[model samples]
Target: MVWEYEVRYQCLRERDKAYTNWLNRIPHKQYALAFDGGYRWGHMTTNLVECINSVLKGARNLSITALVKLHASQLASGNIQVSCFDRQNEVFKVREMPSGLEFAVDLRGLRCDCVEFQVDRIPYRHVFACCASQQLDWQVYVHDVYKMDQVRQVYRARFRSLGNPTTWPAYNGPWFVPNSYLTRVTKGRPKMTRLLNEMDTRMLRRPRHCRLCGVEGHSHNRCRQSAGANADRDAQ
Candidate 1:
């Protein structure tokens, strides 16, 4: 597969100089599966990274100290919620809806028709209802990752207070230097927003052109030039 991609890339480079330059600008090792040690552990794209960035977008503007406090508070509150949920003895009933949709939950098997229990590893509305009906412990259905123990473990490490910079130990290592050639000058105000990719564009449909005649509306196999050539061969 890597060899095929390299061949196709070479063909593209031979055909288009601009495309070749654009391809060269990208790190092929990261994007190409043919490259050695390019495995991404089932993560083919940056969707996870983008999701995390979006989740922390608001926190990005906060001061480092404030952000740390916010995170600690959130973890503390989450642990409290988990503890409260664990102590709950809420009862549920399997009530039939007008729409004829009845949810059956099995706490023993940890399965629910709603599928939320399986996917989220947490008890869904139906599971809660079932647990209430059977008077079973619903907390057991919740995944361990969301338990109070796990939440506490996540925030177990305490942040140490940063002392005065003047009191810090002096570095005896080699002095650091910056390369003037690598430094970039700001021509204008930096863009704070992310640019949309081709997938995000409204104009998605591209006109197909005939590869043989270099014309629209037909492909190489159905081109007039190819038909004419076939006719000439038949005549010969």
Candidate 2:
């Protein structure tokens, strides 16, 4: 998809060099997915539903703590291997045992080539291995949003409840509602605002077909094989 974006960008640049030049003036990391380090989750041009769908498409249905625990367990298994580079930067190359696949880990930037570390805002197995190799603290890379202290801080605020509607201040703002007369008397559930993506498309059943003749255009009632069956039924 990033390659698709790149192809579109190149087309736009070729169509109008001036516009592309202006676009290049802005920081790529601020407006480009290719440079965002998987932080934006490709929501720049998406609607609310699309944005939420895009973000959760790759996320597991587990809680942050549960995912963290799972990753920690993988690290504790000692199946992953890490090799720190000699450069001044805190970059390490990690390889998973019995898999031979390697991932580049940048401790200084708090990111891994696998993107699990940066995207989740938590240290995954690769990050855990990198930290162990460097003797650094993996907790330092975790975002405060996933911490218990932040959750407790949210409840510290005093939210005094408004007693009842009768004692409340008189409302002066104009009220509006849908015109009931214009509403449709539909039979099924109302359609959602979301545009059906590939995932939704996969769940849909195929088009109707003629079971009697094994043809798609018409059903069994209209099929040529149905005539013989109808004649037999009439005699019966």
Candidate 3:
């Protein structure tokens, strides 16, 4: 019964007709139900394991030892807190965003919205999300996701330039390059010097002035007037 549940629940695709027929043959009398799960969801049983899956989703291809190391790294990574920008408040809050999934961090708890946070004490993606969000080095995070062995081969391939760069694999459709810095200069464009001269420098770099306190040295947050105002409120 456990084997059947593992197969039906965990396996990638359920297209095999023989596997489906075999599941039907398992008699209830032959097996003792050990686990107590309340009312199973019909068809696919994903909700039952979503939390676990989220924890393992990023490093699904890793070996058993690698998985254990990944878990340990996750636990340790949680303590390393960073600042998160609150756009609405226009201030930086001292909070930890998970690695890799920093873009999806919950403003309230500073936690990743992924399921790993619920099941395990820490989500592995937090490590990657935090690094990416803060623009910190993410090589270690990538290493964790695609194990060292896989990364080694990838690095070797890149070093050798083994595969054909142009006219290579088709991804079925055009893939959008995310977080790319490359910009293309089309033909018949204005000269670079002319374009730079046409720009309004004032709009590009705002004056170092604080609207809240009428200051020059610092922004509103760090201004002496703002600090004095807050202190006055606390005293009252």
* Higher-scoring candidate on TM-score, 1 or 2: 2
For residues 106-192, could you state the per-residue lDDT of candidate 2 as single tens digits?
877877888887788888888887788778888888888999999999999999998998999999999999999999989767867
Most TM-score-accurate candidate: 2
Clashes of each: 1, 0, 10
Listing every candidate in turn, what is its Cα RMSD in Å to the true structure after a full C-alpha superposition?
28.0, 24.4, 32.0
TM-score, prediction 3: 0.21
TM per model? Answer: 0.26, 0.34, 0.21
Compose the digit string of candidate 3's lDDT tens values, residues 1-236: 35665565445236666755665577633432313232333112344455566677767787999999999888866654545666443223234434532334443343444545444433355544455566655453232434667667765753545477686786698787765456565656555321111123443575688879676756788788889999999999
* C-alpha lDDT of residue 92 in model 1: 28
Error of 2 at 88 (Å): 3.3
- By summed lDDT, the worst window of 10 consecutive residues in model 3 runs over 192-201
- Top candidate on lDDT is 2
Give the CA lDDT, 0 to 100, for residue 25 in model 2: 96
Model 1 has an lDDT value of 0.65
- What candidate 3 gets wrong by more than 4 Å, as runs, is 1-38, 41-45, 80-236
